[model samples]
Target: MKHRRSIELQPPAGYAIETERQALATLPQWFVMHARCRACRHQTPIERRDVIRRCGDTLSLATLARRLTCRGCGNRSGNLLLLEKLPRD
Candidate 1:
């Protein structure tokens, strides 16, 4: 299956994303985060289902990053890469 990205949903960097209970509100449920922790060089793709269940839209990426610990080496902080959506085939 092919995919098309929805770039407009991307949140601005440097500023905190503001929302009551919906983090990344602009993004759809299919959106996922490919995060790489710079400290331990660990990387993983975070599923939206898990994100919503854990943070429930009340969290920001910055806050999430702070809370995440490198599963590989227990390091903190990482870079988040939002994957583009695949078009329906």
Candidate 2:
């Protein structure tokens, strides 16, 4: 049977993240990267590794946002949301 899971969104202040690079370094192997274009509101989901490979490991989250382009609108400006998976059962 396939496993199921749910995400618990708590307060951000509960945890301490010193830097963007530091946070990305601790992400799981299979995290989802949510990219959205500000101009056209275009959004896309990409794998963590693919983003890293495309943007390079040395780039920070801010740099990654600037690097990625929207395929739907061909815009360079966008935001990124990093999501991690949690097992429920």
Candidate 3:
């Protein structure tokens, strides 16, 4: 008999993703990225292709967060990036 190790679906608290590859590894096709503003509690979906195109694949999430601005409040402070799985049809 053979056994396979279970994969971790969720990241631990204060988990820092150093690169896009680390964050996207084993991510399902239904999962999409979003940026949530801490100051105003605003959330918006982000296109992964566009981000990779603009920032390249090696950019860290922390650095990307610092680069993003809240569209709702026009705040320049860092926003939280999240990977949310969408419902299937």
Best by TM-score: 3
How do the residues 12-84 of candidate 3 rate in per-residue lDDT, one tens digit apiece? 4544334455533334567688899999999999887788787786666666777889989998876788866
lDDT accuracy of residue 3 in candidate 1: 32
lDDT per residue as tens, model 1, 1-89: 22366454554463333323335555554445666777666788777668768777656655665566667877765444445455544
Q: What value does the lDDT take at residue 52 in candidate 2?
A: 64
User: Candidates 2 and 3: which is better by lDDT?
Assistant: 3
Query: What is the lDDT of every predicted structure here?
Result: 0.58, 0.59, 0.70
Per-model TM values vs. the true structure: 0.55, 0.58, 0.60
Q: Sort the candidates on lDDT, descending order.
A: 3, 2, 1
Root-mean-square deviation (CA) per prediction: 7.5, 6.5, 6.9
- After superposition, the stretches of candidate 3 with alpha carbons farther than 4 Å from their true spots are 1-30, 86-89
How close to the true structure is residue 9 of candidate 2, measured as C-alpha lDDT?
56
For model 1, the run of ten residues with the poorest summed lDDT: 14-23
Winning model by lDDT: 3
What is the Å distance of residue 83 in model 1 from its true position? 4.8
